[model samples]
Target: MDPLYTTTDDPNDSMENISSNFTDSYNNQFVQPVWQVVVWAIAYCSIVIVSVVGNIVVIWIILAHKRMRTVTNYFLVNLAFAEASMAAFNTVINFVYSVHNEWYFGLGYCRFHNFFPIAAVFASIYSMTAIALDRYMAIIHPLQQRLSSAETKLVIGVIWVLALLLAFPQYFYSTTAELPGRIVCYIDWPEYKIWDFKLTYQICVTVLIYILPLVIMGVAYLVVGLSLWASEIPGDCTDRYREQLTAKRKVVKMMIVVVCTFALCWLPYHVYFLLHMFHPDLLEERFIQQVYLAIMWLAMSSTMYNPMIYCLLNDRFRAGFKQAFYWCPFVPEGSYKSLELKTTRYLQTQISMYRVSRMDTTVSTVLPFGTPDDTTEPAREEEPGCLRHTAVDLSPNGSTRDTHSKTTPPPSPTTTWTSED
Candidate 1:
C-alpha cells in the first residue's frame, strides 16, 4: 500500500531531496491562512481568559468567606477548579493543533494533553451531579440528615478518583505518530479491535459523562420543582419561612438553568465526536471542520458561564462575587446589608417560633406572629441567597426548643462574595 502522506517515490532519492520535500509538505499541511489564524487566535484567547479569570474569582471568593462554604458551594468550587485547570492546559494546545495539524508538544505531553481534559470534564460533570443531588436532598427531605462537611469531602474525593480512572484510556492510547511528514497527536487503538474499542469507549463516555448526569439532574430537579411548587406551607408559616423557601427555590431555579446550559453547550460537541467516529470521511470536509470548531467552542465556553449565572440569580453568590471584585466601584458595602438583615430575621423567626410553640405547648395550634399577607417594613431589595437553620427539639412538657442553637452571628464584613467547591 502507498504511504498515506509520503512525498517520496524512490528509495534512491537523496537525503537532501527527502528533507526538502518533507519540509514543503509539512508547511503546506500545517500553515493556516494569516486571516484564519488571527480569527482562531482571538476566539481561543477570549475563551481562555473568560474561563480562567471567572472560575478563579469564584474559587477565591468561596475560599475567602466562610459564609460561602455551603454544601452546594463546595461542589461549585470543584467545578471551578476543573474549569480553570482545563482552560489553562488545553486551550492553547487545542488552538494550535486545530490550526496547524501538528503535534509540537511531543509524546509525554500528548498523553497528558488528552488525559487531563477528559479527567477535568468528568470531574466537572460529576460535580454538577453532586450539586443536583445535594439540592434534591435539601429540598425534598429538609428534615433528613444533611451531608456533613466530612461526607462532602468524601464524595468529592470519590469523584476525582472516578474521573482519573475513566480518563486512563487517554493516557494509554494517546501518542505522537508520524503521518506523512508531520507528527500528529492522536489515540491509536490496536489494529485487531480498533473499531470495537473505540465504539465501546465512546459509548461509555457519552453515557457516563453526558447522558447519565443529565438524566439524573433532570429527574432530581423535576422532583424538587414539584415538591416546591405543589407542597403547602404550614398554616402558621411566617414570612421568614416563606422567604427561606423562596431562597431555596431560587437556588433550584439557578441550578436548573445551569444544567440546561451545560446540556445545550455539550450536545453539539458530543454529536460531532460521534459522527467523526462513525464517518471518518466527514473529517476531511471544511464545512465539517468549521462545525466541529464551533461546537468545541461552545463546549469550552460552558466553563465561563456558571459564575455569571450564580451572580445573577443567587443573591449570596452575587454578593460573594461583588466582594471578590470589591476594587470595582460598582460593588458597595450597602449591597450586602439587606441580605444580612434578611438572614438575621430568618434566624430570629425560627427561634421565635420555637419559643412561642413551647409556651403554648401546642405545635399545631400556635399562630404566627404576623399575618402572612402583610408586608413588613420596606427594606433593601433582595433575592434568593443563603440560609442557616438549626435543628428543633420537642420536649415532653409540650415545649419546643432548638437542639443546638445560638445567637445569630453578626453580618459578614462585606457582601457579593462567591465561592466554589
Candidate 2:
C-alpha cells in the first residue's frame, strides 16, 4: 500500500511547483482575522471558567447528593473530572502556544500537553458510551438490575486503565520539534516527527475514539430512544409505567444531543489525518494544514463541553451546580456530605416502607392468624391488599379459590391479608 504521508516528499518542492503551476498566487492566510481572536478568546475564557467552576460544582454535586449517584450519572461525573483537569492544566498552555508560537513548558510538559488531551478525549468518549449503554439497559430491562455500585466501580476502573493505555503513544512517541524558531509538540515517529508512525497513530486514535465508538453509540441511542417511544407499557400520561418511560426518554434525548455534538466536533480532525491514507498530496496545501489545526483545537475544546451539558440540561445537576456556584440554600456550608447522607437515609426509608407494605399485602396476609383456635368460619377471607378482604373457600380438593361473595368475613379485623400467589 502507498504511504499516507511522507515528509521528505518535499513540502517546499510542492509549494514551488504549485506556485509556478498556478496563475494566481498561493494565498496562505496568516492567523485568522482579529475578530476571530476576540471570539476564540471569549470562547477560551468561557471554556476555562466554566471548566473550573462547572467541574468543581459537578464534583460537588455528585459527592454532595446521594440522588446523583447512579450508573449513568457516575460516568458523567468521571467525564467532568477529566475535563476539569484538562482545562486547569492544558487549555492555557494551548493559548500561550497559539499567541507566542512556542511551548513555554519544558519537554516534560510538552509530553503532558499531548498526553492529557488524548487521555481526556478517551475518557470523555468512553464515559459517554458507558452512560449510553447504562441507559439502554435501564430502559430495556428495568425489572432486571443492570449495574450495581460495585459493578460501576469496576467499570470506572477499567475506563481509567483503558484511557491511559490508549494515551500510550503521547507519552513515549511524542517529542518537541523545532518549527520556525518555536519549539512545538509533535510525535517523533518511525521516519520523522510529522510522518510515518505519527500518522499511523493518529489514524488509530481517530478510529478508536471517534469512528468505532461512534457506531456503537449510534446503535445504543437508537435502541434506547426507540424503546422509550414504543414501549408496550400503556398509559396516556399519569400511568406509573408511562411516567417512568417519559423520564427515560428525556435522559436518552439529552445523551443523543451530547453524543452527536461529540461526533461532529471530532469528525474533521479524524478526516484530516485519514485523508493522508488516500492522498498525501492533499496535506501539502498550507490552507488545508491550518484548517486541520483548527479542527483539532475545536475537538479538544469539546472536552469542556459535556460538563456544560450536564449542568445546563439536567435539573438535578443544575440545582447542585447552583448551590455550588451561588451557595444556594440546598447545599449548606461544610455540610454537603451530611446532606448526601440525609438523602440516602430518605431514599432508604422510602424503599423500606414500600417493601413492608408489599410484604404485608402478599406473604404476611396469606399466613394463618395468630389465634389458631379461631376457625369459626369455613375458611379465612382473601385480602387483595391492606385490610380489604374477600371470602375465599377451600374446595373439597383443598385448593384455595377466590370467592368474592360478600357473605364471608375475616375472623378478625387484624388478620393477614391474602393476595394471588
- Specify the highest-lDDT model's number: 1
Off by over 4 Å in 1: 1-31, 193-195, 231-236, 329-421
Question: Mind giving the per-residue lDDT tens digits that candidate 2 earns over 183-258?
Answer: 5455454565566665667678888878888888899888766766654543222232233344455667778888
**Candidate 2 regions with alpha-carbon error over 4 angstroms:** 1-39, 177-180, 192-196, 232-238, 276-293, 327-421
lDDT of 1 by residue, 1-421 (tens): 0011222211222445445656664356535579978987888888889889889988876666654555677788999999888888887687777666667898898889878887898999999899888777655665456676678889999999999999998688765556565676666644443357666787898899999999999999999898877777654444555765666667778888988998998898888777756665564444544565567778888888888887788666676677667788867763653223222111112222223454344221121121111111111112222233345555677667754322222223432212122
Best by TM-score: 1
Q: Tell how far residue 216 is off in model 2, in angstroms.
A: 1.2
| TM-score (all chains, Cα) for each model | 0.75, 0.68
Worst 10 residues of 2 by lDDT: 345-354
* Model 1: residue 297 alpha-carbon error in angstroms: 0.9
Q: How far off is residue 288 in model 2, in Å?
A: 4.6
Report the number of backbone clashes for model 1: 16
Q: How high a TM-score does candidate 1 get?
A: 0.75
